[model samples]
Target chain A: NAGVTQTPKFRILKIGQSMTLQCAQDMNHNYMYWYRQDPGMGLKLIYYSVGAGITDKGEVPNGYNVSRSTTEDFPLRLELAAPSQTSVYFCASSYSGQFSYNEQFFGPGTRLTVL
Target chain B: AQTVTQSQPEMSVQEAETVTLSCTYDTSENNYYLFWYKQPPSRQMILVIRQEAYKQQNATENRFSVNFQKAAKSFSLKISDSQLGDTAMYFCAFMTRHTPLVFGKGTRLSVIA
Candidate 1:
């Protein structure tokens, strides 16, 4: 399996511009997540989906949106980008079941720079 | 709320030596999971090891192991017979049922030959 894959490995956006970071998983995982990592900081969750059509906010969801219309794709949208949004974004997925300890598979991550 | 903390920002060790990276977390949930992820210069998040809070015995994966202290809320990773390939930024993470994983500021580890 390709596991999890993210598109646009590197991107630069002007202030007020918009773009979408695409994430896809071939493992058919029921849980998918979006996270952003700043320099010298831990990753903070932006949004997540338990399943298709069920999306929720996370710790730092401002200036971003997500849609999980299918099990394999969970795309993140950046609307009106700001410099504060400059960071490395990661996509991860995990198999959902009665247990909670399943390991999450992560993508290589996309580096975004907003000017 | 759940939070993971890695106290060490950077550490180095000679090849074939042993090194331990400390981690502590805050959570009220009794049952959860802890993980150590390694990110190299390539920027890929690799799962190194994992531990279940309810398991009394520690988890080991080849040269890597974890010391899980449920009562102390501490989960530290120990690397035995370290190699230069082990150089990476290590992250400690925590997760409860039905919640997003919480990550700590990564500890940069350099294995010198």
Candidate 2:
């Protein structure tokens, strides 16, 4: 199965512009997450969904929004993009918190540059 | 709150040699999970190994193994006979039942031939 997939492997946005980073998982995972990794740094969570229709803010959720309308899709929206939002974004899925699950499979990631 | 720390920012090893990546975490939860993920140049996050806090024995996956020290809050990954393909950024992550998974800054490992 394509564990998880993210669209737009690369993107460049102007300040005040907006875009959506699409993510999907075919594994029917109950948990999906959005994370951003700046150059030479670890990833910080932006948002997450335990299940469809249940989304929550993560460590760094400013300037972004998310929705999990279906089990397979969790898309992140960037509004009024700023240079600070320049980073590599990742989408991951897992069977987390259910019956002792192990790992979270991730997508290749989307590299965003805001100018 | 839980925090994962990878002290070594970068490390290198000769081909066929062994290397260890150190990780430490802080958490009050007694039962939780720890994970090590490898991100190659392709930017794919690959799960290398994982450990459960309740388990006394460390977890091993083929050439990759973890030295889990629950008392010290340490979870180190040891790669045996490092190969060129093993070169990647390794991140240590922590998660408890109540909180979101937190990740360390990561240690860059270079396996040189």
Candidate 3:
């Protein structure tokens, strides 16, 4: 299984541009998340979905949107890319059930640079 | 809201030695989960270990273990017999049931040869 995979490992966009970062997981996890890691900082949650057709905002959700139409794919859309929006984006998934703890599995990450 | 703190911004230890990284969290909730994730130069976030707030017994995985103090709200990671591969930016995170993780700034650990 590929676990969690993110597309366009690297990308550069000009200010005011728009793009989508694709994320897919083969683990069949019920929970998917998007996090952005800034330089010398920890990953900040951008968006999360408990299951298909259900989504919620996390700590940093501005300028980004996410939709979970299926169990394996979660794509993050940046409507207007800005320098402040540039960072390393990570996609993570975890199984949710009767258990209290959900261990998150992360992707390799997509490095985006908006000039 | 919960907050995690990693006081040590940077730390180093010689190969084969043991080093402990500290993490403290603030949450009124009595039940939750804590995690320590290692991010190497490659930038992949790898889960090092996890601890349940209700479990008094610490969790261990090979050379990586956690000392979870529920009362103090402190969760420290101890890496024994450190290897060069242990070098990475370690992050401490917290979460309630079914909630997203709240992460600390991170502590950069270097394993010297």
Candidate 4:
């Protein structure tokens, strides 16, 4: 299994610009998530989906949006990007949601810089 | 809200030696899961080991073992006979049924030969 994969290993966006971070997993997981990690800080959740076409806001979802069109893909959209959004983004997936002992599989992460 | 803390910002150990990374968490739920993830320069998050809350026996995977204290709310990773390949940033994470995983700031561990 290829596990989880992310596109655009690195990117730089201008202030007020918009972009999407692509994430895909072949593990056939039902739960998918997007998280951002700032320098020297732990990762904060951005958004997640329980299954296809079911997305919800996470702890730090103010500047971001997500869509889960299929079980294999969950993309994060940043609208009007700000300097505060400069961070490494990670995508993860699990076989099931809470109450199960499934471990999350994380992608290599996309490094984004906002100028 | 659940929180995980890794007090040690950095640590180093000689090759073939043993090192322990400390972690503590706060949560009201009794049944949950704890995980240790390693991120190397490659930036991929790798699962090192995991522990289930209700299980009394500690979890071990090859050279990695965890000392889980349910009462103290402490979970520590012990790397025995460490190798240079083990150098990475290790994060302690917590998750309950139906909730996303919460991660600690992480501890950078360097294995020197």
Question: What would the DockQ be for model 1?
Answer: 0.72
Residue B21, model 1: lDDT of: 99
Weakest 10 consecutive residues of candidate 2 chain B by summed lDDT: B93-102
Name model 4 segments beyond 4 Å from true: A97-99
Model 4 lDDT per residue over B7-92, tens place: 99999999999999999999999999999999998988899999999999999999999999999999999999999999999999
- In the predicted model 4, the residue pairs found to clash are A98-B97, A98-B98, A99-B97
Name model 2 segments beyond 4 Å from true.
A98-100
Query: Per-residue lDDT of A4-101 in model 2, one digit per residue for the tens?
Result: 99999999999999999999999989999999999999999999999999999999999999999999999999989999999999999988564244
The collision pairs in model 2 are none
Show model 1 residue runs off by greater than 4 Å.
none
Q: How well does candidate 4 score on lDDT at residue A87? A: 99
Q: Residue pairs in steric clash, candidate 1?
A: none
**Model 1, residue B60: what's the lDDT?**
100
Computed on C-alpha atoms, the DockQ of candidate 4 is: 0.72
DockQ of each: 0.72, 0.61, 0.65, 0.72
Stretches off by above 4 angstroms in model 3 are none
Clashing pairs in 3: none
Question: For residues B67-100, could you state the per-residue lDDT of candidate 1 as single tens digits?
Answer: 9988899999999999999999999998887567
